[model samples]
Target: MRKKLIEAIKAAFLSEGYGFFQGFADKIQGSELTLPALWLTPIEVAGMSGRNDGKVTYKIVLYLFVQNEQYDEQQKEEKWEELERIARKGIATLPMISDVISTDKVTIKPDEFAFTSFGELSQTVTFLADVYFCNE
Candidate 1:
């Protein structure tokens, strides 16, 4: 289920024209975290939605990773900001999600980000987009 949510978000990002990439844990075992070794990029534009109150709601959230060992604290912060900006730009360039209610952007320490579940993350996406995108 968690994997599915991650994939859904990745798909959403791809649909928005941003490259959705994933790096598997196995490939990061010994190599420096400086560069991503196992990355998965989505090939299509897609949206994930759930039905609520007789309506379909679409939303997405993404977890971007940067190697802490390779970047200083300031660099990590900058990278996150940059990534978020890029994500927003990507979304802005794409066709609007007529079904979305709202959207949100969150930044957390790497450890906190690592501990979040895919479902929880997905819920955040739903809430953010729904609150803003949905027109009551």
Candidate 2:
């Protein structure tokens, strides 16, 4: 079931002309990811009962990375604008996932390391997806 949800997310991002990865940035070894990428994987899964059908909640964090290439003042503004646009689109796309019963409001935080080492600006968006699975 988790794999099904992951594939659905990949397909949705692909349809939007974006690629979705299934793990964290630190986990990648030698592969170079294209800038403006999205990454997510289930960080936690909990089972709950006492409701209609038992529901499992998947705690997911979605990350978006944008290349912070050198740019003029005007271009800097454009870069920030592009980041905001992509983040908004990602938020809107979450609840549309199949079997997603609810999603909590999220806060997208900027990664501070962008100014130090990585020349790419990234944002982390976190939310929980509750899914009801019927007993077989």
Candidate 3:
């Protein structure tokens, strides 16, 4: 069920014309992914009050890591435009990926860029969604 949600996210972004980006559900190794890539995985699932088939709804935090190449500030405004576009599209794409069950609002927060173990500059955009997918 969680796996379906992950795939749905990638599918949504691709169908939304973000096919240029790569999506991952596990820890990426090396620098396998090119710039503007994304890593998505379930972090936690907490039970809530809503019931589904006698199961409790859940609040899930899906981690999204956006990897990118070094940004050259001696660049054009469109470069900035493009980055913002990616962020916006990423945020908009996940909410529509409620595969296992209906999902509530999705909240996304893109953190500052950090160097990954692979030495690539990446940003973490944590997406929050509430659904009815209990791990059981």
Candidate 4:
């Protein structure tokens, strides 16, 4: 199920011609992320419980890490907003899952967005995009 979500998210980003990004990623997917890249990982899954009548609800926590070069707090703040915008756009761009799944009750939204600096030019922003869906 996690893999399916990852593939779907990756496909959506590709279809939208998004910038450097990865799904099902543990660390940087490629060399240094080019200073402006996005990473998606399913950090956790909520307890699953529901009816056995061919439908099940699932909740997933997908962490999105966006990195950009920032020299100071002001720059970090500016880029954090941009990263938030990008993250939301990416989530909105996600295509519907397979036909077997029912998204009628599904919802996707940003749980949180944060900014931190690693070094003089290495500033990173992270956010959690919570995904809720139903599948058989």
Q: Among these predicted structures, which one has the highest lDDT? A: 2
Candidate 4 segments exceeding 4 Å error = 15-32, 54-67, 95-136
- Per-residue accuracy of model 4 over 12-108 as CA lDDT, tens digit each: 5555444445435445433354333345544344444444433333443343344445436786666556556655565555435432243222333
lDDT of 3 by residue, 1-136 (tens): 5556666667755554443333344445533554445555444565555344333334444333343445564432344455456655655655565534444444544434443554444434444444454444
On TM-score, the stronger of 1 and 3 is: 3
Q: CA shift at 80, candidate 2, in angstroms?
A: 4.3
Task: Identify the runs in model 3 with alpha carbons over 4 angstroms from their true place.
Answer: 15-31, 51-81, 94-121, 133-136
lDDT of 1 at 122: 11
Q: Write the residue-wise lDDT of candidate 2 on 28-119 in tens digits.
A: 43435676567775557855654555888877676766777776668766766676676666556656866667766556676655522447
Q: Flag regions of model 2 displaced more than 4 Å.
A: 50-52, 71-81, 115-118
Listed in order, each prediction's TM-score against the native is: 0.38, 0.74, 0.53, 0.49
lDDT of 2: 0.65
In model 2, state the lDDT of residue 79. Answer: 66
Best-fitting candidate, measured by TM-score? Answer: 2
Compared to the true structure, candidate 1 yields what TM-score? 0.38
TM-score of 2: 0.74
Q: For candidate 4, report its TM-score.
A: 0.49
